[model samples]
Target: MMFRLESVDARQYRHKSKRVGWTMAALLLVFGLAFSQLLVQSFGSSFWLNALGVLLGLLATSLIFAWWRRRPDMAEVRYVTRLKQHLARVSAHLSTLRQASRQGDVRALDLLAFYHQGMAQLETLEGRTMDDDAERLAERLELRKQRQLHGLPEEVAGFDPAELDAFRRSEPRT
Candidate 1:
């Protein structure tokens, strides 16, 4: 026999399952009491009617429980709304990064790298590509780096010896 597992969170599943079980149990208990009254009043003559009533009660309980479980919870609805808003903000930020890089802003390069790293992590989790525009930005940054290295001015001034020493000390050893 094949069993189909639901994809709900474990906590949510446990909570909902417990609630459904309790509801079904209560419904069965009430139906059992009512059926016992009918059986007693009929002098135990309506045997088939009693069995039918029990089956109908079970069917009603199952249908109600299934309907309740199938409805979307408020928490899940709010979560999806927030997720959509966050994705929209990310798209806008990525567009801004692309525009800034296109204008030859060096700071945009660092920002793009940071953003790309974060998107790469998300891509790994989601199993999809999230860097279509990032690839072009990366290429442009590489070209700009090469240009800056080759067009350097001679005798660069304002050398900070302390900062240089600190930076060197912070480097990882090979």
Candidate 2:
């Protein structure tokens, strides 16, 4: 089952449950050790020290175990944030391309190249960008090509229009 902390009541319940569970476990452990120590000190000799030693050792091991369990959450949050930022950067580059293209600036070609490179990297990172957006981008590039027939012709440049169509077809719809 998925744990949803989306609502205030759910968040409160999780917080309270976690606090109660940890508190109860700690109290039980402390009482267990205290009882063991008292029994050993009263009914045995030189064994309360050993009991205390064992209790302390278990406490240390439990702490290490808890840290191990919690460490992955931190790592996952870090990577997810990084991936989100990377996606934003790619989108920003695409925006730069669009703006430069609108201004009829020659540098827009360079920006378009950079945007394609960024998209390639994003594809490798998570492949999560919307397929429709990619198709629109490819269509826009095709329109730009027809408008500015100044670049090398597709035949002489060994550029296959079919490849662009193939890429659009291969992507999954959003």
> Which candidate's lDDT is highest?
1
Q: Compute each candidate's TM-score over C-alphas.
A: 0.32, 0.29
Local accuracy of candidate 1 as per-residue lDDT tens digits, 1-174: 111111234355345546656878998767766765676577665767777667766777777766765576634323333334433443455555455555664444444443443344334433456457776556546645633654632212222234323433543355
In the range 14-125, model 2's lDDT, one tens digit per residue, is 4544654686577557655765676667677566565765676567656754674456433433333343454354354455446545555444443344345434433444
lDDT of each: 0.49, 0.47
Model 2 scores worst on lDDT over the 10 consecutive residues at: 1-10
Q: Tell me the lDDT of candidate 2.
A: 0.47
Superposition error at 20 for model 2 (Å): 32
- What candidate 2 gets wrong by more than 4 Å, as runs, is 1-96, 138-140, 143-148, 152-174
After TM-score superposition, the amount by which residue 109's alpha carbon in candidate 2 deviates from its true location, in angstroms, is 2.0
